[model samples]
Target: MGNMDISLKEMMAIDGAVGAAVVDYNSGMALGVVGGSKDLDLQVAAAGNTEVVRAKMRTMESLGIKDGIEDILITLTNQYHLIRPVSGRGGKGLFLYLALDRNRANLALARHNLRGTEEKLEI
Candidate 1:
């Protein structure tokens, strides 16, 4: 069972990771954050992404899609934003957000690592 600190630390270790946060989507609050610079504000990212998650969930429900979201990826000109909702009982309504430098990050590897981290996370 991994704690938030460990989970966040692991996230930051990912190649090209610039910032990471564990957020409570229900309240749009960040439980923990790490690795943000002057240009990257994790708190703002957390709050803004909460709406993204909610909107997607709503859309899925409205469309009668029963599948759960594994993750959401947003690509920018220079970066990649990844949002992964926690699936464990202890982490309900929580998510892990990661921002990566597109040039340095291997998207497939990052996604795989995030999934492993989530599986071991204990909120």
Candidate 2:
């Protein structure tokens, strides 16, 4: 398995990958990040998105569904924000957050690649 740096770098190489981050949901902090626009602060975005993840998890628990989240998608007018919680052993409490330009990205492929990255990412 690859470490955090290699996993995140590979994600950044995808087409339309404007930015990516490995964040700790429990703390709302970015453990590693790549690419960011002056208008888009990766850290701030990560912090805000942590709330989204938490809220969803809370809602799921309230429903009594035992399944875990595979991914969460937020589509905007111009961009797609993808939030995927890491799974498997020792992957709890972490997620891979990726932002893409909708016009340039293939969401299906990005989802596949992100799943691979999630398997490799170490913490």
Candidate 3:
């Protein structure tokens, strides 16, 4: 079982990974993070992304969809941002935030890898 540290470490192993964080959407806080760029503050990114997650969740509720989120992907010109909520009961209210260079990363593979990582994550 992996905790926040272990999960964050695994996220850093993704290709072209610039940074990764374990964030609490309910509180807009990063419980753990690693390998962030100085130009892009991971803490701020994590907190801001919390709103994205919440908005999507709220929309889902409004639409009357009962299923949980698997992940959220935001693709930009140069970067790919991935937000994946933890699935287990132990990881309630938290998510994994990852950023990668679009040119250097494979989005599909990264998604698959992150899913694997989340499944084993203890926290």
Candidate 4:
């Protein structure tokens, strides 16, 4: 299994990746972060996205949907934000977040890579 640093490094290697982070949705804290410019503060994004995850979970509960979320995607004019909640035994309450440049990224491939990374991540 891979550690956070290795996972983040793998994520950054994805085409058009601008930023990546492993965050704990329960506390809105990032356990590890890599590649963020002034335009994209990964720490702030992590905190904000915690709410997104929480709201979705609550909504699903309220609606009585028993299925778990595999990933959440937010599209922007210039970027694609992908949030994947880690499903491994040691990864509960944690997520992998990746930001990609829209023009350069292959959404399907990026999603596939992110899922693979999540599966291999140790924490």
Candidate 5:
């Protein structure tokens, strides 16, 4: 079982990682954050992304889709934002948000690493 600090550190070690946060989507709160640059406020970004997760969940519900979300990817010209909802053990209403530099990141490997981190994570 990984604690928040350790988990955040591990996430930051990922290739091209610029920032990472563990947020409570239910409350739009960031429980833990790490590695944000001076230009980016990870806490604020985490809160804003909470809305994105909520909106997608609501849309999925309305569409009557029973499948779970694997991850939400937002690609920009120079970066990638990865949002992964946590749903194991006691996890619910929480997610891991990771920001990566597009030039240095391997999308597939990052996703795989994030999944591994999520599985070992413990609130």
Candidate 6:
């Protein structure tokens, strides 16, 4: 378990991590961000991903799927984007966004690590 800053740093330590952020899906804002390059804007990405999360939630509702989302994965030619909702009490509407280099990252391990980090993250 760790504070927000620590958690963000820990995420950046993951293999092939390019950037990471804690986002508010409701507001499409990033509460905290780390490890983004000039070409990769974490804040903008976070806001855009908020829409993705909302759309998925809406689809799930329409389908009557009660299962909670573990994470949403978007694979690109050069990168991978992961969106994981926070499950802790008082953590709803928040999610962790992680971007990684596809060529260098192990997707399974990165997901595992991010989930573990999400469990430990403190608002």
Q: Model 2 — which ten-residue stretch has the worst lDDT?
A: 1-10
lDDT of 4 by residue, 38-110 (tens): 9999999999999999999999999999998999999999999999999889999999999999999999999
Q: Which stretches of candidate 3 lie over 4 Å from their true place?
A: none
Cα lDDT over the full model 1: 0.96
Give the Cα error of residue 10 in candidate 3, in Å.
Answer: 0.9
How many clashing pairs per prediction, in order?
0, 0, 0, 0, 0, 0
lDDT of candidate 5 over 1-123, digit per residue (tens): 348888899899999999999999999999999989887799899999999999999999999999999999999999999999997966788999999999999999999999988988888
Question: Which has the better lDDT: candidate 5, or candidate 6?
Answer: 6
For candidate 2, lDDT tens digit of each residue in 1-123? 348889888999888899999989999999889898997689998999999999999999999989999999999889999999999678799889999999999999999999988887765
Reference-based lDDT, residue 4, model 2: 85
How displaced is residue 37 in candidate 5, in Å?
A: 1.2
Clashes in candidate 3: how many? 0
Every candidate's CA RMSD: 1.3, 1.5, 1.5, 1.3, 1.3, 1.4
The per-residue C-alpha lDDT of model 1 at residue 106 equals 99
In model 2, what is the error at residue 100, expressed in angstroms?
0.2
Question: Which pairs in model 6 have colliding backbones?
Answer: none
State the displacement of the C-alpha of residue 96, model 1, in Å, after optimal TM-score superposition: 0.5
List of clashing residue pairs for candidate 2: none
TM-score of each: 0.97, 0.96, 0.95, 0.97, 0.96, 0.96
